[model samples]
Target: MLDQNTSAQLKTLLERLESPIEIVATLNGSDKSDKIKELVTEVAALSPQVTARFDGTNKRAPSFGIAKVGEQPRVNFAGLPMGHEFTSLILALLQVSGYAPKVSDEVLAQIKGLNLTSDFDVFVSLSCHNCPDVVQALNLIAIYNPDTTATMIDGAFFQDEVEERKIMAVPMLFQNGEHIGQGRMTLEEIIAKLDTGAAAKDAEKLNAKESFDVLVIGGGPAGNTSAIYAARKGIKTGIVAERFGGQVMDTMDIENYTSIQKTQGPKFAAEMEAHVREYGVDIMNLQKVSSIKGADETANGLVEVTLENGAKLESKTVILSTGARWREMNVPGEKEYKTRGVAYCPHCDGPLFKGKRVAVIGGGNSGVEAAIDLAGIVEHVTLVEFDTKLRADQVLQDKLNSLPNTTVIMNALSTEVVGDGSQVTALKYKDRATDEEHTVELAGIFVQIGLLPNTDFLKDSPVELSKRGEIVINERNETNVKGVFAAGDCTTVPYKQIIIATGEGAKASLSAFDYIIRSGQ
Candidate 1:
């Protein structure tokens, strides 16, 4: 199954195995089963410590379990772990063979200390870039705790179960047969859900931290850049984020990032985080900021930021780079049918709607690209645009128009998402030119309108904001509030590109440092 270079790489990786490991598979005499057998046999041949057996009786055919030689398999793959899941398979192999995972010691301890016996089944599509994070997280949990088991189920291969469960999203997770989550989730998020006291303890620890010279509020490209620049100045720096990578995690392709020729979003985000780590910046992920108080509001005369968990962190200088998120339709039934039939990420959730009719809710580059991509997998695509003409580049518009399965509706306003109480059935829109309302029957709706700034927490603060809710900043990236600055998509920067955000972040960090030196704080 693996090519020459890939086999050589796997052989090199397998040299780190500390103990013997076994791949026990269950086959049912089918084409997929034969392929699985060949894959396992080839994998076993790579290392002397690895062995394969096809005598097991797992109900899921063409499936295999990876485990230490004599232990019960805690990590399982119900389908071919190729594509984005290839890394997950490799990690499972290494971790099960006694190689330590790269997670923190605290997180590792939490996983091993879980008192509950849980079974996690994650449904994923091969093309989804976000699926590997969820799969690898649960796989790590299973590796640490003997009572827990994680099984990765490829939705494309197991169509019957996906249909029965009415799954329309990738990385949909179920615990003990109950649907728990339906999107990308981190290992910390999963542990916080299982361990009820974790948040309280974490909050207490955060509250006890000493004040920082510079504290960044987000973990996107902007926030990471600011943190790194601040840390390099020999000052204490920290970053608290709801989730690292922010909107970048949802992006699919990025070719305009200067030196890099081409790269995926998640991979770029991972590399950004790794680079920030080299600067020794304290990073706290999966934490939400509830409010930000000016320097005068705190007794210590330092800027204060409060967390959703009631943890208050004090910093001399605060940099806000909260970033933005996908703009919602905000129409009737849109919220109710989210994940059921409505989705914002075409690259992540497109595979679930194969051979089905879908609608794209914009005419910009993102929407046009989504329509062009979905036309290949879905039966038909209806592109609805509020403007009179498409705003995408000429090349993209030409490609979209060439697709036979695509229909473009210009000067149409989306009114509502019509659903049958469970899933979307059609999209309601009105023709701007004729004032005629129309409905397009579809099984899925992909919203690619635009982005909304994540500045809700700063609404009541003293920082000035533009009419569009973006934080107002000067050329130096300084906000109106003293000792506070802003950058990235959340700020009044004309364009919201990753490179621009990164430059703004560096400028903001330098501006904050200058402010501190002038004030002698």
Candidate 2:
């Protein structure tokens, strides 16, 4: 199942095995089963520490399980682990063979302390860039705790199960046969869900921390850059975010960042987090700031940040890097059918609607690019644009127009997402030119409208904001508040590129430092 170069690479990676591993396969007299057998046999031949056995009673045929010798299999694969999932397969092998995972000590302890028995079945697509994170996270939990078991099921290979469960998105997780979550989720998020008391404990710990010299709110590219810059000044810097990596985690590919030719979103976010850690920046992930009080509004003359969990933190200066999120259509049935048929990330969820008709909402670059990409997978793509003309670049519009399976509708506004209480069946729109309404039958709707700044928490705060709800900032990225600064998509920046966000973050950090020095704080 692996090529020459792949086999050599696998052989080299397997040399790190600390103990013997057994690959047990459950197969039948089918082509897929035969392929699984060959894959397991080949993998076994790569290392003396690995052995293959083709006798098992798993109901899912053409499946395999990896485990250390004489131990129950903790991680199982229901289909061929190739494409984006090949890394998952390798991680499972090494982790099950007594190799430690690359997680923090606290996280490792939490996984090992879990005493309950739980089963996780993650449905994924091979082309999805976000699937590997969920797959590898569950595998790590399964390896550390013998009571937990995780199975990575490729949705493409198991179409019957996918349809039966009505799974319309990739990386959908089901715990003990009950739906839990969907889309991109990190290992920390998975644990936070499993551990009920984790949030309260984290809040208590955060409340007990001392005041920081520079405290950054949000964990996107801007927040990470701000924290790194502030920490490099030898100041006590702490960053709190709802989720590290922000919306970039949902992004698939990023090629616009200069110096780096191309990189995936999750990989780039991981690199950013690693770089921030090198500067000793206090990183707090999975924390949501409910509100902020500037030094002018606080009794102690210190910038005060409040968490959703009632945890209060004080800082000398604050940098607001809270980024933006995908704007919703706000029409009926959109919320009810989210992840059922309404998806935001095309690259992650497009494979789930193979050969089915779908609609792309928006006429800009993202929308046209999604339609063009989905044309090859889905039966037909209908691009609905509210504008009179397509706003995408000339080349992108030309390519989209050339696609035979794609249709573009101009001056149309999406009215409602029609669904049958489970999944979407059609979309309702109105023609601006004739006041006529229309409906298009489709299996999925991809919303790429625009972005809304994540600044609702600051609506009542002292920081000045623009009419569009974006944080208003001057040339130096300084907010109207004396000690507060803003940057990135949350600010009134013209462009929302990643590189621009980083530069703005650096400027905001420097501005905050200057404020601190001038004010003798």
Which structure among the candidates has the greatest TM-score?
2
The per-candidate count of clashes, in order, stands at: 0, 0
Which parts of model 2 have CA positions greater than 4 angstroms off? none
Error of 2 at 336 (Å): 0.6
Write down the TM-score of every candidate: 0.98, 0.99
lDDT of 2 by residue, 115-227 (tens): 65888999999989999999999999888878888999988878999988999998899988999999888999999998999989998999999999999999999999999
Clashing pairs in 1: none
- Per-model lDDT: 0.92, 0.92
Q: lDDT by residue for model 1 over 328-440, one digit each (tens)?
A: 98999899889999998888899999999999999999999999999999999999999999999999999999999999999999999998887889999999999999989
